[model samples]
Target chain A: MTSIINVSNLSKTYEGGFQALKSVNLEIKDGEIFALLGPNGAGKTTLISIICGLVNASEGSVTVGGFDIIRDYRQTRALIGLVPQELTTEAFETVRQNVSFTRGLFGKPKNPDLIEKILRDLSLWDKKDERIMNLSGGMKRRLLIAKALSHEPQILFLDEPTAGVDVELRKDMWNVVRDLQTSGVTIILTTHYIEEAEEMADRVGIITGGEIVLVEGKEALMNKLGSKQLTLDLLTPLEKIPESLIAHDLRLDNGGTNLVYTYDSKSDRTGITSLLNDLSANGVKFTDLKTNQSSLEDIFVDLVKQSS
Target chain B: MNLRAIKAIYLFEMSRTMRTLAQSLISPVVSTILYFVVFGSAIGSRIQEIDGVGYGTFIVPGLIMLTVLTQSMSNASFGIYFPRFIGTIYEVLSAPISHLEVIVGYVGAAATKSTILGLIILITAGFFVDLQIAHPFYMFLFLILTSVTFSLFGFIIGIWADNFEKLQIIPLLVITPLTFLGGSFYSVSMLPPFWQTVTLFNPILYLVSGFRWSFFENADVSVGVSLSMIALFLMICVLIVWWIFKTGYRLKD
Candidate 1:
């Protein structure tokens, strides 16, 4: 797959010698949802801002659709849509007017049909004529997405799109993102919400301390680092692990009513058979057994901790 | 030249002016008429005439200039400043429009509004006093030039200011006082020799004198000098704006 956006060794150092972004490189494939997962102040917005031409990078370069962002700024900017983290919209203008004006700002010819379609898709059609200040916060966020889509940009950058949003709105935003991807628009989103990235992203990039720690397919990343836990409900309570079953790393929980054993799923040999034999040899009995796999959140926390 | 982008910004600004018609248009027009009623009547009755023109008529140019100066600056300053305050300026910054297009659109809309207001005041003055334009062309020339120049100046203030207090500081404290002291209501020549010479340093004097000369063919300073001073100021404003965009000062981090 061809990459629609490329960042080659980009770095940003703000005034007073504060380094916001270290030397970093990334490439986003066309028509895929690439989620940048990072903590606050990890230069997620900085990277997006430089690519959108809102901030200049101190070193290296970026290109959108094969055009250098700084050299062909207008061309690159015209191809990208940015939904900023801030809810910034003209309060006095009606929703329709605000969206239409953004189209004009990109030097795009007026297309009422396109504007209407975008507003409708974002569930803002009914409130098209209402002034923005009158709209609710969720509506306002939808309006921002509508504005970003006004010019039909090929790449969309959503900087913390669902930040501070309620669960319903976040779900709604995820659907909208999926629809955009279905229409062949590349998506790049920055989020601190692990669930959001896990739910939506095709590929995930983890950024920490002004550096990209890892970038991999979401499913692959989860599978490679995932661990499984098996819990056996004891027939009766026990004081401690018996000497016969001491070889297996097991912990008694629930006042010794449950035996919990953790093992890596990726390993060829899980040692489950050996552990079960040892438990039987020790005369330990279990009424029930259940297994759980670690989620992306656990992997993310572990990865960040390891890197730090 | 992205005409569409410029039109987008220009129309957006103009629509804002329309939305605040009472504050942007009516207030200034009403205030200008009050100046005619109070200063033009009371002062005209006593002084009769100054520099061979009726007091009411002589102050007409000054009144219009005062209104135009303040309105143009306030309009342009507020037009740009509000976006920064609301953080909507990022929309324009990230758009495909060039910096020149942004300036032209904003300053153009502001100058257009101020010129309209100035003309309206000129017609309103006709009701209170007999007026004639010695050089009709120069009247409009000075009017448009002043509006555009000051609008540019206001744009600078908008970018330089980080807060509401800073936005109002220049227009209220500096520009207003300078307009008054620059002989907006009276000729600078009326001052004593020493004061008159000192008054020549005031930039506002040239703008008012040149504009007044366009009306009655009378001025405190030569027309050429007045025109050149305005041209010089316009150039300086342009250069400063250019530098602002080039360095991304107060705009990009």
Candidate 2:
């Protein structure tokens, strides 16, 4: 995929001398679900704001759809839609009016058909004429998406769309995002929910302390940093691991009833055969064995931990 | 030009006024009526006329100017300030709009509202006082210029203000006071000599004098000076608004 959004050596330093973003560089593919993952105060929102033209960068530059964000602001911003983290709607405005207003702000002609479709897709059609203040938290969150999609932007930025949202709604939003991606809209999201990134992103990026620690395909990241574990539930509790099996990395779990062995899932030599033989020789009997592969969350935790 | 965007903003603001019609329209109109009923009636019947006009007729232009000044500022200030307060300003900032378009949409809506309110009050004032428009064109031109200029000023206040209290500070403490002391109820000639000299310095005086001259062709100051003062003030407001967008001041960080 071609790069549709490019950030070249971007930095943002606030008036109070708080450096929100370091010298950062990134590129988002033309049509992909890219998740920017980070902990609290990791500058995720700041980066997204700069690209959307909501915040000015102190140094460096960004371009959306090959148009410079600042010099061709109208062209760049016209191609993008932003759902900010804040649940900010015109409280007095009806749902339909709120969504339709955004279409105009994004320079799109009024199209009630498109507005109806968006509201219906988000399950907000029934509440179209109702005041926004009357909607539930989940509905309000969906309204943000509907408003963002009003102008049919080629790219959408979801800044913590699922934050403070319930699980069912989050899953529902994940599906909506998937549908958006299928419809050919590139999505870039900033989130602290690692699972959110895992469940939706084609590529995952980990940021820590204003810097990107790593960016890779979700599966590649999991495989690269993910470790697997084989837990041996023994019939007899061992006093200790015998010295003969010392070479194999092992640990006692469940108060000595289980002997767990950990190894890189990607590595060819797991040494399970040699460890089993050595275990038998030492009378370390096991009734059952089960293997567990690490998940993206595990890799993310490790990556963030290492960076910070 | 972003005319569609401008229309959206303009209609959205007008809709807000429609939603609260009592407050936006009726309340101001009622207050103007009260001023006419009491000050223009009870007081005017006893006080002598000034500049060959009845006391009731003399205050008509001042009342409209007072309404336009406060309404323009509050309408425009509140229009922009509410979005910033609620955090919907992000949508505005990220929209594909130029700063001029943003100002035009907001200030235009504000000026429209205030001008309409001013006109409504003028019609209402005629019921209480004998009204005349020596130059109808200048009457409208002065009203519109004052509205647009003060609406821009209110836009600045909206951006500068961080809280509700700050929003009310300028319009309430500074502007309302200046309007009252700047001959809203009496002619500048009625004030003592030193006070008259001091009142001449109030910008609202020029606005009031210019607007009054459009009606009665009698003003405390020359129409040229009034026109120049308003033009200078309008230019200054435009300058500040430009700086705000260029620097991203309180709107962005």
Candidate 3:
């Protein structure tokens, strides 16, 4: 896939000498959901702000759809939509007015039909005439999304879109994001929720300490670092692991009623059969067995720990 | 020029004015009428005249100037400050519109509101006193200039201020005092000679004098100096606004 956004050697240092982003480079593929996962103050918002032209970078350059962000701000910004992390709407303005005004800000002519569709899609049609301040927090967030999508931008940046959202609203927002992706809009979102990144991202970029530590396809990254844990229910309680089972990465759990073996799932030799044979030989019998695969959360924690 | 963007911002701000008509329009007019009641009627009967114009009539331009200056600054400052406070400024900053267009939209709306308020007060002033305009065109010219100039000043204050208290500082502590001392209630010529020279240093004196001149064709300073001072101040404000946008000071991190 062709890249829609290109960033090279980007760095940002604020007035007080705090470096928020450092030599960070990234490329977002066209029409793909790319999740930027990072801890707070890891420069995720800073990165998004710079690309959206709300904040200036201290150094480096960024281009969206072959146009430099600074040199061609209008042209580049016209193609981008940003739903900021903060739930900020014109409190006194009606929902429809806020959305329509945002479209006009992009120099798009008034199109009530388009605005209506976006509002309906976001489930904000019923509340279109209500003042924003009167809406519930979830409804307000949806309004922000409607405003962002009012101009039908090619690229949408959702900064912590689901932050502070309830489970139902988060699920709704995820569906909204997925629907946008199906319509061929490239999405770049920053999130601390590992499950959100796991569920929505085609690719994941892990950032820490003002740097892009790793960027990889979600499936590939998981498989590369994923480990499987095989839990064996003991026929009888054991005080400790048998000497023969010591060679395997095994641990006793559940008050010695379970013996758990951990092994790389991607490895050619899991040695499950050999481990089973040794277990029987050592007089350790299992009544039942189950395996658990490591999740994206584990890998994320590992990456952050290693990088820091 | 992104006229659509400008119109969008302008309409949004204008609608806000409409929604708060009681505070934005009614309050100022009511206060000005009160001024005409106390100063125009009570003082006018006693003093009769100052600078050869009726006491009531002489203070009309100055009263309008007081309201115009304060209204322009407060309106424009609050116009931009609220967005920053609520974090909606991100939408405008991230939009395809240029900084100049953003300024034109906000400052233009503010100046329009203040100018309307000034004209409304002018019309209302006519009810209490026999007001005469020697130069109607210059009167309007001064009105527009003062509105636009101080609106720009307020825009700068909006960007510079980070809190509600900071936003009110310049208007209350600086602009309001300067306008009062700038001879809004009385003529500087009536003051002793030393004080007249001292009053010349007040920047608002030029705005008040220039506006008052357009009314009676009489002023403490030459019309040329007043006009030059206003034009120079306008240019300085424009330059400062340009610098703010160029450097992204307070607007960008």
Candidate 4:
């Protein structure tokens, strides 16, 4: 995929000298769901804010669709939509009016059909006439999304999209994001929810301390660093792992009734077969065995810990 | 120029006035009527005329100026302030529209509303007094100029303000006093020489003098100077707004 957004050596320092972003460089591919995973205060919001023009970068530059964000702001901004982390809407305005208002602000002609479709897709059609102040928190969040999509921007930035949402709403949001990607919209989402990234991202970028430590295909990232564990349910309890199997560094669990062996799942040979043969040779018999692989959450936790 | 974007913001702001129609239209009308009864009828009975115009009719322009100036400032200030306070201003900052377009949208709506209110007050004053227009063209001109200028000033106050209290403070402490002392209730010519010189320093005096001159050919200053004062104020406001957008002031922190 071609790069749709280029952020080169971007940095942002607030008036109070808080450095929110530090020399960050990122390229967002066209029509891909790129999830930016970071801990709180990791500058996820700052990075997107600069690209979207909500905040100014202290150094470096950003280009959206080959247009400089500062020099060609109008063109770049016209191509993007942003759902900010905060739930903000005109409290007195009805849902339909607010969304239509946003579309107009983006310099788009009024498109009632398109607005209706977005409302329906977001399950907000029935409540289109309701004042935003009266809507539930979840509905308000959905209205924000509707406003962002009003102009049919080619790129969407969802900053902490699912921060306080329920599981059902999160699922619905994921589906909406997926549909947008299918329609050729490039999506960049900033999330601390590791499972959210696992569920929706095509590519994952790990950011910590204002720097991107890694960016790779989600599958490749998981497979490259992912580890698997083999567990043996022994026929009888053993106080300790046998001397012959000490080299494998096995772990005992459930009062020594279970034995666990860890290995790299993607390595040429999991070293499992030899371990099994050694278990037999040492008379470490087991009634049953099950292998388990670590989740993306594990990989993410380790990466963040290492960076910190 | 993003005319559609400007139109959108204009309509959105106008709709807010519509939602509070009674407050926006009724309050000013009521205040004008009460001022007529108290100052025009009761006071005019004791005193005859300010110049050639009757006491009741003399205050029409001043009354309208008072409301328009205050209304324009308030409408414009709150129009932009509410969005920033609510955090929805992020969309505006992120939108493809230019800063000039934003100023046009917000200040345009505010000025339009106040101009409409000024006219409504003019019509309302007609019921209480016999009003005359010496220069009908200049009447509308001064009315629009005052509204647009103050609206721009109010736009600045809205952006400069960090909190709700700060928003009310400028208009209340700075503007309200100036409007009253600017010869809105009494002509500057009636004041003693020293007091008249002090009143000359109030910028609003130019606006009131010009607007009233349009109605009765009577004024505290020449119509040219009055026009110049309004133009100068407008230019200052325009510069402040330009600086606000240029520096990203309180909006982009």
Better of 2 and 3 by lDDT: 3
What are the per-residue Cα lDDT tens digits for candidate 2 across A1-308? Answer: 89999998999999999998899989899889999999888999999999998899999999999999999999999999899898888899999998999999888998999899888888899999999999998899999999999999999999999988988878778888888899999999999877778778889888878888788998887675568899999999987878888799999999899999998877788888888899888877899999998777777778778877
Candidate 4 stretches with Cα past 4 Å from truth are A229-262, A266-268, A275-294
What's the residue-level lDDT of A102 in candidate 2? 90
Error of 2 at B241 (Å): 0.8
What TM-score goes with each of the models?
Answer: 0.91, 0.92, 0.92, 0.92
Ranking by DockQ: 3, 2, 4, 1
lDDT of 4 at B8: 94
Local error of candidate 4 at A203, Å?
A: 0.7
Give the Cα-based TM-score of candidate 2 against the true structure: 0.92
Q: Give the distance in Å from residue A210's predicted Cα in candidate 3 to where it truly belongs.
A: 1.4
Worst 10 residues of 4 chain B by lDDT: B44-53
Residues A193-258 of candidate 4 have per-residue lDDT tens digits of 887888889999988889898899989977754788889999999998777788995899999999
> How much lDDT does each candidate structure score?
0.91, 0.91, 0.92, 0.92
Clashes of 4: 0
State each model's TM-score restricted to chain B: 0.98, 0.98, 0.98, 0.99
Two-chain DockQ for model 3:
0.84
Q: Candidate 2, which segments miss by more than 4 Å at Cα?
A: A229-269, A278-293
Candidate 1 displacement at residue B105 in angstroms: 1.2
Supply the DockQ value of model 2: 0.81
Clashes of 2: 0
Report the lDDT tens digits of candidate 4 across residue range B1-253.
8899999999999999999999999999999999999999998778778887888898899899999999999999999999999999999999998999999999999999999999999999999999889999999999999999999999999998889998999889998999999988888888899999999899999999999999989889999999999999999999999998887898887
